[model samples]
Target: MPSPLPSRASAAGPVPGRYDRFLILGAVCLAGLVLPLSFTAPPVAIPAIAAELGGSPVALNWMTNAFMLAFGSCLMAAGTLADTYGRKRVFSIGIVAYAIVSLLLALAPSLAVLNGLRIAQGVAAALALAGGNAALSQEFHGPARIRAFSLLGTAFGLGLAFGPSLAGWLVQTQGWRSVFLSSLAIALLATVFGVPRMRESRDPDAAGLDWRGSLSSTAMLALLTIGVLEAPERGWSDGWVIAALIGSAALLALFVRVETRAARPMLDLSLLKYPRFVGAQLLPIGTGFCYLALIIVLPVRLIGIHGLSALNAGLMMIALSAPMLVVPFLAAVLSHRIAAGTLCAAALLLAAAGLVWLGVEAAAGSVHGLIAPMLLIGAGSAVPWGLMDGLAISVVPKERAGMAAGVFGASRVSGEGIALAITAAALAGLLQLRLSSAIGVDGATLTQAAQRLATGDAARAQALLPQLDAAALVHSYDAAFAWLMYGLAGLTAAIAGVVFALLGDASAHEPAALAEPARDDRIELADEPAC
Candidate 1:
């Protein structure tokens, strides 16, 4: 393939002395690796991190959630800042900040300090990673742009694939501190490569930042995420959970109101009117809610319900994860013949089918029934895994690329985050209800039986309530699992139809810029983009 970057831009070029895009792509890929590695590796180190810091379970959970909360909420705002102040400037500073914060995270003496530093580390990562992606979009076009994005996908996959094993080894060999300490290399590499080679680009006509929109958007997302994350642990009806859920909805509506009136909104509201962009945006949500939920639930079921060894359970996960990582790269070959929307919809349908297939296996209540379903889900997941990011940002102008990158990240993060939450809430709610009905007993015996059943202590459960109908309870649990899977399947199918309906053949493989926003109107940015 021809190089995506020219040796140098002509002095008279339209974008003004643009640097080699390949160098920027390199930086972006490295930055992309941060998320998957940060997410996957740290869990393996959780025990060590807690041991050294004298951590409580709450604090331990926050150690991971703190990073994600900060990272996910601030992404769009960070992108807007990158675009306004200049991508190169923000990106360079972010790299340095990331390095410093990561070091602090590694050496933090207290759990509180470690949690605080994780939050800081996440903010810094958002700046570097989003800025780098926007830089690539600004510099490259057409086939080169696609290839660069593919490489970013590859970097993320490699991180996910290698992170757990590497982190496990590092923790065993050196200490848990090695996980955070090792991240310094990623920051260093990105800064060294990006600071010089990344060209400065921003909306010169863009007005001041929309602090209102930024704060509201951040609060809305953060609150909603907190509510969801706490739901399974705290129970959905807990006072704090109820308040958070209500507060998030209120903030969301307020955020929409603020964006519409703001002189310079952080997220552009105008872009949402476009059908194709909306379709691309939904793709992540659909795939994420359906197949991603399977990834979370299946392993638990394998070990808990099916009574598989951890090793065997992991192998089943491989059936899902292996294809998920591999098929995206292969899907690129079909671009020449297939419309992007068609392929995207087809991918969602495949994933939907896979979810239903899993439900069927779940209904069978046998460990042996899972292999084919896992493989099917894995293959389904791979199809849109390659295309969703590009589809999200492609329709917007290159200048708004940072905002688009932020949107892309937010969609995936939110989708995965919220999907898991929804699935948990649904299953928990339905499980309790059904378990109560099927396990016919009154008073304390019913409550005790329910708890034991939830813990998978069949013998104790039977003893707790001799009247408990064994087959009835089993049917109820199976139904709960099936309810989640099949519901997700239907949702994915609907989203697929929306994508196929909204997107035209001509707009499918190509970025569709319907019309430029009037200069005076290009003030506010959207959560997704300059929508």
Candidate 2:
């Protein structure tokens, strides 16, 4: 079982909390762990899911994309609901809903059914994450809040670290459906521990939900994701692809207009004016390029192109995620002494270097060459991951914690979805170019094969191009992947510079004036150290 988060009180806040508060932290942290499992584990199970359910590569791809799309797009709305209704109420509903959706996912009859359920699961996840994180901000303040979020980051790391390996074992032994059971069990535990003790809190001044902003933003994200995910399967020039892209742009403008005009906007457009706030938003986007993209892509490359067993591929992934287990806590500790912008910039630079190293190593096509680069990337990413949540809410007033959490969470998750889609599409397009040059196949044939290969459906990819052996496919994929890595490296490096400039030196300090508010539901802690 995962350990509970520390309840140590910061000097700026009141004393310490009772055991019940620890239970609340445990529940939220467990739920946090489950979200990453839903993400990282499923990629490891793709081949198993495809083998049993028999879906097209595009359909299999949507299994992940659909969930991320729903989760990312709904986060701001979930945050709004959390603040308007009650944080505890929304969290309870979300946890219950997540448990139900997990069961449905386990029993799904087809990929299509599973995809629909995954979308529901994503919405539930958004509610749980946004509500839980917002509620946590109410419970802690000053450095304690940073530690709380740091532990949350560690929980996320735990899931990412073990999810692939654990899912591999479950899929190998109990079948692919068992992966969902893991989430079901965790959700149940979270519900039991978190729901009963969590104190209900809401914004006293909140007017109501910003329906227009919610709908427009959600629609914009959906269209953008659809456009990116479809680009590889349908050519970029296809009418529907062009239409979706244009629709996404139009909706984005509509969303911006709606938010700016609304009396009580779901997201305050004015927050973007703060350089530190903008920098906090960019943190996840930078990690999306360097870390999250690899989480989706590398498993496919290892299992499908390299022909590794699910178990082996998953174990191999541990190298990339293991640093997450400790690096986040270390980064949090370092924040007290280091300027946050400098720390984050240095971390991103490290990840950029790792990406470049990985690109060189990938060209050699050896598993051993991957470890150092992956570890470096993971460690670098862990720094920003640990600090981002705390920094997000800290930048805004305490009264707007929900909105702050929502905006940051939305930016983070949606950036992930966009990065994954763009990376997949870019890989497919690059592979098509390689295939055209190498095999001289027709555009249609090359396109189909590249799409399948990009999504890790090597069996169908083989069927599409039976003339090419596995080695040839692997070679083509490696070339494309190497180029992709180099591009990501350059982008990551550039983002680091921008983040440094925007965050500045003042972003790290948590002023005591912004201390914890006294509330009826606030838990009072003892002055002693937490066990």
lDDT of 1 by residue, 299-410 (tens): 5566655567756776666777777466766666665567666777887888889889878877777567777877776676666666666666677655566677777777
Q: Over the stretch 372-484, how does candidate 2's per-residue lDDT look in tens digits?
A: 89999999988888777878877765556677778888888778666766787789888888878878766677788898899788788878888888888888889989999
For every candidate in turn, the CA RMSD to the true structure comes to 5.6, 6.2
lDDT for position 280 in model 2: 83
Model 2 alpha-carbon drift over 4 Å, by segment: 1-18, 43-61, 107-113, 437-442, 456-473, 506-531
What is the model-wide C-alpha lDDT for candidate 2? Answer: 0.81
The TM-score of candidate 1 is 0.85
Q: Each candidate's TM vs. the true structure?
A: 0.85, 0.87
Best by lDDT: 2
> What value does the lDDT take at residue 187 in candidate 1?
75
**Candidate 1 worst ten-residue window by lDDT:** 522-531
